[model samples]
Target chain A: MNYQSTELQHQLAARFVVGSMRGLARRRFQRLMMDIPKLRDEVAFWEEHLHELTDTIPIQQPSERVWQRIQSRLGWVQSKTETTSKWPWFFGAFASLLLIVNLVMLIPADPVIAPSIERVAVIQSSEARTLWLIEQREQRLEVAAVGAIERLPNEDYQLWMLPVDGTPPISLGLLPQQGDVILDLGTRIDLAQVAALAVSREPLGGSPEPVPTGPVLYTTDLIRM
Target chain B: MTTPQTLERDLQQIALGDTAAFRRVYEATSAKLYSVSLTIVRRTDWAEEALQDTFIKVWHRAGDYTVAKGSVMSWLISMVRYRSIDLLRNRANQELSTDDFDEIPATDTLDSSLDSLADSKQLRVCMDELQPTTRQAIQLAFVYGLSHQEVSDHLREALGSVKSWIRRGLESLKRCLQR
Candidate 1:
């Protein structure tokens, strides 16, 4: 187990780099490399040697929504505070003031704010299981799942907005586990003479197949709002 | 217009809890990470989830990054690779049949600029020196993230043969690059 023999160590390092080395020997080698400067250098050498293999991959940009979601989840948009003073008290008082002002502003606003009913449709499977809900309002279409269905391991359900004109269904992105996921329907889709909403099971990430192999779990007619 | 050194410096700032640096890191590497994730997971949603999870992990563990481990970009790629591997491992359980190991259509071409990087250039030269079968075996293992059994099954070669090919191919690569 001498960590210093350049020849033997280099061979072990090469095997480790290619992922051919496994079991306790690989784990021990990784741990040993973490400590011995010479072993670390050898491992890095392999990493450098094999690094270009990654270049064979083409760069792809993910949807912009990814950034938005990351920002929202990380609370990155929240205001930053730097004052060392008893700022909690000051913020609490300021929040209370804003609340009072909002209450005052709402005193005679409206007794019954209309629940803005829009044309909507809920697509269900042959078993009458609701899979997705589509709503048209404010010149936009919103699509979401009906309930929290347990996601199958390595499978995803995608919502497609199909138009009556017999064109291909536009992907609205992956369905959420909960909450109403809103989508903007541009001029590309016609609201009138709209066909039924459909759901399809795709690979883990979603449909790479232009045509889905999984059955259409649900379809529902769109009712006018 | 930032140089790689400058990018690494910015990433170091991110490691120190700088939100601006975090945004910069996301801007710089999210797409590349997403491509790697999507290739492994083969689904958009799961790839998105992997991307989210990887970045979150990066945020929490940025402090753990050491210059000694590798370059900032390599370290980041390793994080994506590890997360994708975990996803792949879990997914592999459901679709583990030998029939599903057929050849996947090649979708994207390799970037030549990355080929010009000093380290990548060295790797390219060494990889080019290996036998075709051995090269494919190593690429399937590292790039496609296939297990040894998967490689053996896909190549229709014995499991021992696949192992030896990878070991020998990497050894040759190491020696060629060292020269």
Candidate 2:
């Protein structure tokens, strides 16, 4: 019960650094480590201690195709920007300025998209800032976020779709730290059975297991959109 | 041909935005990095994806590395590990199946061979001091990047107990290595 006990803290810190820390405890430990410089030191110590484990694995070369895929993905991201730039004439400076001005004016006068579904939810962090927007439209569910959140250099946040049926929550994807992200529910699960949207702090990318390793940071009812 | 040290110097130069150094750094580390990717991912396609991402990350985040952290190899390995883990975790979630969990190679064979080369006696000595359970827990978690739950399941031990073992094991190893 006494997590602060010297012996217990050392034990937990060591396990965490070596990667044996798991579940809610590991998540808590990670947050604690981030906040406490001493704890981070303990982690780095373990990392150095266990560095030799890497030697046990044979150095197998990844196939050339792996390199090709990375290049292509990077290329794709670059090309997307290029393609968007090509539309500048249609969405050129004057038109863009007008659209921005209109959006700014609409912010106060017009309500953001009203929920059409029976119930809609907006999940926000403890700081009361919007983190996710969940809405049901045309009997299909949708999740959206306005921007990627900035996170500590060493951490990541993951999105989850929880269902009211008490079944396991499905991972949506890694949350963007900046810029809006939209996910389509795509007639997969019954919209009525959906419960709430949840977010968990995870290793970069997301949790490896079906169950989340971190605590649920936010949860809110889905408003009808 | 550049030596590892020379390659590392070039990487440091690349970190300073020297394009020539970037090309050299890529040439030097790509094979080893690709090998690391293949071993963890087990899929050539995914490994390639990881390799590409790792380098791009290196290009962008090169300045983040500090010598105090460890060797260039260590820093780069950490990046690759994190990236590889991300890719593996994403793919695992998409598949919705646990059949293809990454496996750490058996240590006895790998260690014995490395012992023959014996480049770093300190590592071998430190490893020898660990209890089998502690050693196994650390190996599974660090080398394979298995979550604590996975390591517990793999070892068929209580999750709490596994955590303690790994933690204590790492502490003990650190003490030994530091000497």
Q: How high is each candidate's TM-score?
A: 0.55, 0.57
- Compared with the true structure, model 2 gives a TM-score of 0.57
Q: Give the Cα lDDT of each candidate.
A: 0.62, 0.58
Candidate 1 per-residue lDDT over residues A144-225, each given as its tens digit: 5555465554466777767788877766556544323345455566667567667788775568866555766766677763
lDDT of 1: 0.62
CAPRI-style grade of the A/B interface in model 2: acceptable
Q: By lDDT, who's the top model here?
A: 1
Model 1 C-alpha lDDT per residue in residues B1-179, reported as the tens digit of each score: 55567667877787688888888888888898898777667778777767876776576567777777678777777667656765565444443455455433221222233344455466766766877668777877777677788778767789899888987877677668668
List the lowest-lDDT window of 10 residues for candidate 1 chain B.
Answer: B105-114
**The candidate that achieves the highest DockQ relative to the unseen native structure:** 2
